[model samples]
Target: MSDATTSDPGTRARPVDVSERVALLDVLRGFALWGVFVSNSFAWFSGYVLLPRAQAQALSAPGLEAVVSGLYHFFVNQKFITLFSFLFGLGFSIQLARAEARKSSIVPLYSRRLGVLLAIGLVHLVAVWAGDILSTYAVLGFMLLLFRQRSDRTVLTWAGGLLVAVPLLAPFVQHYGPILLHGAQAAAQAAKASNEIDLRAKEQLLAGLSSDSFWTAQAANARFLTHMVPQSKRLLWMASILGRFLLGLLAGRYLLLQEVERRRSWHHRLLFWGLVLGVLGNGAGVVMQRLRLAGLVDPARDPWMLAMSAVMEVGFLGLAAAYVAAFALLFQRERWRRVMQVLAPVGRMALTNYLLQSVVSLCLYDGWGLGLIGKLPPSRCVALTLIIFALQVPFSHAWLSRFRFGPAEWLWRSLTYGRRQPMRLAPGDAPASMTG
Candidate 1:
C-alpha cells in the first residue's frame, strides 16, 4: 500500500496513525479481489453468458470442462468472496479499535463508512457492472453493529447458523414455496436466459464475418445490456454469494474480538483441516459431475448434487480462511512484506480499483468501447488481468503516498460527513478526529 505523506499545506505537520500492521490483511484482500477479477474477466471479455444451456455448454470442452468445474467447485463463488467478506469484518474491528483508542463513538463513524460504501456500490452497479457487492456489504454492516458488543461465542453461533441455514433453506423454499413467491420469477429468468443465449449466438455468428452489419450489432448490444441488468440484480439471491458474506462476517467478528491469527498452532491446525475438507468436498463435486455426465446420475432431479455443492462451498471457504490466517502468521518477512505492502495500497482503495476495473475492461472488451468481447481466450484474459493489476499497484501506491485516502475513499468520507475531507498527504498527516 501507499505510504502516508502529507501534501496539503494545511495538514502537512499533523500526525498520521494509519495502521501498518493491516498491510498483511490488505495483501490478502488484494489476492481475493484479483481472484474475483480473474473469474469476471472470463464473462467480461469472452461473451460467454453463464446461463442458458446452449452458450454455457458451447464453452465446455473435455479439458476445459474439468478445469471450469473444478474452479467453480473450489474457487469461483466460494473462496474469493469469503476472503473479501472476512476482510470486511476484520476492517470493522479495526475501525472500532481505532475509535476506542481515541475515545470516540463507533456507531456514527462506522455508519458513515458504510454509507460511503453503499454510495460507491450504487455507482458501480448502475453506471458500470451490476454485480456490485459494496452496497450489500454496507447494508449488512449496519445490521452487524447490533452484535458488536455481544460475546464472541454468541456472534459465532448466530453467524454459523445463518450461514448454514440460508443455503439449505433457500433451495427448498424456492422449490416448495408458493409459486407466487419465486416460481414465476424463476420461470421468467429461465426464459430470459434462453432468449439471451439465442440472441448472443446469432450476434457472434454474424459479427465473426463482417463489421458492416450495423443492425445485427445494434440488436446484439441491446440484448446484452438488457440481459445483464436483471442478471446482476438476481445475484443477491444466489446462495453461494450470501453464504460467503455471512461466513466473512463471522470471521470478522472473531478476528475483531479474538485475534485468531495471533495463534500459530491454531492457525496450522485450521490450515490442515481446511485442506482436508476442501479436498473431500471438491472431490465429491467432481465425482457427482462426472457421474451426471456419464448418465450414472441426474443432477437436475437429484438432491445429492445440491448437497455436494453445499459441502464444496463450505470446504472452499474454510480452506480460504485457513490460507489467509497462515499467510498472516508465516509471511511476515521483508521480501514478502514488501510485495504485500504494494498490494495493500490497491486493496485499501478497493472501491476505486474495482470501478477502475469496470472502466478499463469496458474499454477493452465492450462493443461501445474496444469491442474485444468474445475474442479473447482464458489465457489472454488472465494476462490482461495481470497487466491491469500491475499498473494499478504502482498507481495506488503513488496516490496514497501523497494523499490521506484514495480518491473514491476521500469522496465517500466527504459525502458521509457532509464536509470536505483533507485529501493530500505529507509527513505527519493526520485524519480528522471524529466519533465512530
Candidate 2:
C-alpha cells in the first residue's frame, strides 16, 4: 500500500506509476504538430506577411479569391497553433500525473527538459530562423510549472482572465501607446524589409549560386537579429502569446481531470458547437478583410478588428478541443486505433520532425538550395505539404520498426537520464496494447 497524502485528509494514498504514458495523446500531438506545417506552409514558402490577402489576390478572380479566403479563414492559422499549445498543456498534465503516482518531484525533471528545449530552440533560432516558437514555449512552460499543483478551477479562472484581458487591452496599447514606440517599430520593419529586398535583388542578379550567397544571407540575417527581433519580441508579448499559453495549460488540466472524451454525448455537443462558432467567427474576419480591401472600412486600425481576431482565436481553441474529443472517441475502433498507433512513433519524436521542418524549409527556400521562397502559390504549397506528410508517414513507421525510440527522442532521454538509453527494438520487445 502507498502512503501518499491526498488533498482530503481522510483519503488513502495510491501508488503512482511515473512511467505511465499515453500513446493516443502522443499520436494526436503528432497530428496537431503536423497540422502546423499544413497551415503555415503557404506563408513559409511564399514569405508573405498576410497569407489570406495573398491568397485572395493570387486566385483566378475575385469570386474565387473570396471562396479561397472563406475556406482558409474557417480552417487554418487560428486552429493549428491552438492545437499545439493545448497539446503542450496536455503533456504537462500527463507529466504531473505520472509524477504524482510515483511520489516523485516533477519540478526537477520537467525543468531539465525545458532547459534542454530552450537551448535547442536558441540554437535553432540563431542558426536557422528567428521565427522559432520552441524557445517561447520553453519560457512559458517554466511559468506554467508554478501552477502545477493548483486546483483546476483556480487555473481555469486565472487562465480565462488572462486570455480575455490580453486581447481586450491589445487594441488600447496599439492605439494609445507612445508615438515613439510606434515610430520605432515602423523604422525597424522598414530597415528589415530593405535588407531583405537587397538580398533578393542580389540573388536575382547573380548568374549562378555560389558560397557568397550563404555569406550574404547570414549577413542579412544578422541585421534582422540586431534590429528586428527585439521589437518583434515586444509586440509578441503585447499580443498575448503568454495568455494563449496559459489558456492551453488550463485546457490540458481540464482534459486530464475530467476525462473529457469519456463523456460521449457532451463531446459530440462540444464538437458541433466548435464547428458552428468557428465558421461564424472566421467568416466575420473574411468579410472584414474583404471590406477593408474594397476601401469600405479600415480594419487595420479598428478595435473591432482586434475583437474579430480574438473571436477567431477562440473559435480555433474550441475546434482543437473538439478534435481531441472526437479523436479520443473514435480511437476505440480497432482500425482507427491502429492508424493512430502508427502516428504515435512520430509524435514521440516530434523534436526531430520539428527540426526536420527547418532543414526542409531551408533547402526549399535558401539561395544555396532550391530557392523557391516567395514564388509558390497557395495551392502548390498545399500540394507540397501533402507530399511531405505522405513521405513522413512511412518514414516514421519504418524508423520505429527498427528502433525503440526516434533518434531525437533517444538522445533527449539519454540526456535526461544522464546515461545511455537503449535504442533498438529487441527481438522479444512488444508494442503496448491500446487503451483509452
Model 2 off-target regions past 4 Å? 1-20, 50-56, 59-69, 179-212, 232-261, 300-303, 431-436
- lDDT of each residue in 188-257, candidate 2, tens digit only: 5765676576555434323222223766554554444555455533554433555555565665555642
**TM-score of every candidate:** 0.76, 0.81
What do the candidate models score in CA lDDT, each in turn? 0.60, 0.61
lDDT per residue as tens, model 1, 1-436 = 1112222343322223454345566677777788777767765445554334454554554476547645654555456766777676666665555555565556876676677778778766555554566777777778767766777677666665555655556555544454466675785576567666756754653353224443444455444445554552244344344445445555554562245436666677778887787677667766776676568886445645555545666666677766676666655565666545556667777777877887788677666566666665455666787899889878877777777677776777667667787777656753211100
Candidate 1 deviant stretches above 4 angstroms: 1-16, 19-21, 50-52, 60-73, 177-261, 287-296, 428-436
Best by TM-score: 2
Best by lDDT: 2
